[model samples]
Structures are given as structure tokens and as C-alpha cells.
Target: MRHIHDAPAGLIDFLFTELLLSLKDQGYSEFSLGSVPLAGLEARRGARFSARLGAYIYHHSTQFYNFEGLRSFKEKFDPEWRSVYVAVPPGANIVAVVADVVRLIGGGGRDRVGGKASR
Candidate 1:
């Protein structure tokens, strides 16, 4: 999904359409483009600390992630988005839960396969 923004107008769209058509020909009825982290988060009254933090990061962390562009690219397909939720038990620290989820994303202490990403 990491495409050059300078690509000619409609080039990305053409490619995406072809890909989807190919998948359909393969008898695939659905396609998942995966999660766009920090996308669609909003800050409002009574929002949880984690939600607010996610919103702030989404707005200010473009140097690290092109959240807006990615979200826009994914939206072209009329995709359905699922909500992300974190469960914190009583007395649990939200920061710790977030950190653990991040760790799980980055190899998660699992043994690498052929020195590549985790299985």
C-alpha cells in the first residue's frame, strides 16, 4: 500500500481496481486491506485517555505514518472498518496494555523464521 504520491492521476486507482477484479475472478468475495492505525479516532468530551492519545498521535505523527493518505487510499474501495478496542481490567494501566499490543506487533518475542518476521 506504500505508493508514491506523485504517481500519475488514476494510476493507483486503475491498479487497485484490477487487483480487486482479479481477486473476484479467483472466487474471492471479500478482501481485507488491513488496519490503518490511529485512523478515525476522535477526541470528544468524556473520551478515554487512550482514545484521546490516539487522536493526537494520528494528527501529529505524519512523519512516522501517513495516516490520512492511507485512510483515503483504503476508502476508495468502499471498505468496511472494524473498531479497535482495548480492555483494561480494574487497576490496570492503559499504557501497559498499549505497549504490550505494540510488542506483539513487533515480533512479540517470538522466534524469527529464517531470520525474517515472526510466524
Candidate 2:
């Protein structure tokens, strides 16, 4: 059973709100929607050089990636955004590590877990 309101919140939104409320009641302080890589970068005064470059790429590279859509979906939950970065060890093969991670995440040409790609 659910209460009907003048403006009905969609099921996904309603469930998300309930989840957040439950987490709060259980004393959880934060909810994290993991990064949409290279999304939501913005240039601001005193921002780092890498961040400025990333922002430029995000704004300009829509054809190459779906940065806007990724950001929009995450924004629906009213979550705060923060920059995340990875550090590599000296002499490590970054490309290999990335490929391994992609494979592990089932992003390498197929979904290993469900056997279907998620839209």
C-alpha cells in the first residue's frame, strides 16, 4: 500500500527516498553513487590543471562519451559530486591494469554476471 500525492513520485525515486530515509534512521551518514568517469568536471578559480583539462574534455567530447547523461542520472538522487582520482605505482603498466579492471568489471565486450549488457 502507498499513499497517493498530488504530484506522484516515480517508483524509482520513491524507493530511493525510502532507502535514504532508512539509512539515516540506521545512523548511516552518507550515500555514494560511484563516479561516472570523466563526468561532472568543471573549471573554477584555483582548480588544478588536470581538472581544467578534464572539464574541457567533458564539455567538448560528447560524441566520444555520454558525460551529460551519466551526470544527469546521478543528479536525480540529489547527491553531492566530488572528484576522484587513481594513483599508479612507479613503473606499473597502467594500460594493462585498466584492461584487467574492465574485464573484472564485466565491461570488456560483455556482461559476465548476467550475460546481458545493461543500458
Highest lDDT scorer: 1
Off by over 4 Å in 2: 1-9, 41-66, 88-119
Give the clashing residue pairs of candidate 1, or none: none
Q: Which has the greatest TM-score?
A: 1
Q: For model 1, where is the 10-residue window of minimal lDDT?
A: 110-119
Ten contiguous residues with the weakest lDDT in model 2: 97-106
lDDT of 1 by residue, 3-79 (tens): 68788888878998999999999999999877676677788879877788778876876775566777888898899
> How many backbone overlaps does candidate 2 show?
0
TM-score of 1: 0.68
Tens digit of per-residue lDDT, candidate 2, span 82-103: 8766665766554454334334
